[model samples]
Target: MLIAKVYITLKKGILDPQGKAVKGALYSLGYEEVKEVRVGKYIELTFEDGDLSLLKDKVDEMCKKILTNPIIEDYTFEIVEG
Candidate 1:
């Protein structure tokens, strides 16, 4: 079997309101040492073992088509054998 681990995050230079909210909450809780905060999404997909290159292409397509926004978000994925 193969597992695809996908990580999605906002591109740099884009405003992240959710991250800012989390940081503000942390500060309210007295965590002043935190300089910045960024929130991201993690996704795991399981599939039957197959052609590595083809699977990679499919996963990339999936990310581009549905998993992440091409204009504001960036995504990276790794395939692991299980």
Candidate 2:
């Protein structure tokens, strides 16, 4: 079996209003040291054993097609085998 950890985030130069809100809330709650906050998504996936290369390719395709929006977001994943 293999485990995949995926991270999805907005591309650079994209505005993140939710992150900004969180930063503001933190600052109001006495977290003045907080500078910027960016929100992202994390996903964990498990797959049956297969060729590592093929598994990686499938995961990449899944990320591009469904896990993230190609125009507004970027994603990367790490695969762990067991």
Candidate 3:
């Protein structure tokens, strides 16, 4: 089996209101060292044995078409055998 671990995040220069809000709340709670924070998404995909090339292509396509906005977000993924 193979597991796909994906990490998605807002692109640099994009405003992340939720991250800012969380940071503010943390500061109020005495975690002042929190200089900045950014919220993102993590996704895991599990698949049976298959061609690695095809799997990578399909996952990349899915990320581009449905998982993230290419203009405002960046994503990375790794495939691990399990």
Per-residue lDDT of candidate 1, residues 12-68 (tens digit): 989999999999999999999999898999999999989999999999999999999
Listed in order, each prediction's TM-score against the native is: 0.88, 0.89, 0.88
TM-score, candidate number 3: 0.88
lDDT of 2 by residue, 1-82 (tens): 8999999999988999999999999999999999889899999999988889998999999998899999999898999985
Runs of candidate 1 with Cα error greater than 4 angstroms are none
The segments of candidate 2 whose C-alpha lies over 4 angstroms from its true place after superposition are none
Per-candidate count of clashing residue pairs (backbone under 3 Å): 0, 0, 0
Which 10-residue window in model 1 sums to the lowest lDDT? 9-18
Ordered by lDDT, highest first, the candidates read: 1, 3, 2
Best by lDDT: 1
Residue 37 in candidate 3 has what lDDT? 96
Query: TM-score of model 2 relative to the true fold?
Result: 0.89
lDDT of 3 at 24: 94
Q: Report residue 17 deviation for candidate 2 (angstroms).
A: 0.5
lDDT of each: 0.96, 0.93, 0.95
Candidate number that wins on lDDT, 1 or 3: 1
Write one digit per residue (lDDT tens) for candidate 3, span 1-82.
9999999999998999999999999999999998899999999999998999999999999999998899999999999897
Q: Which residue runs of candidate 3 sit more than 4 Å off their true CA positions?
A: none
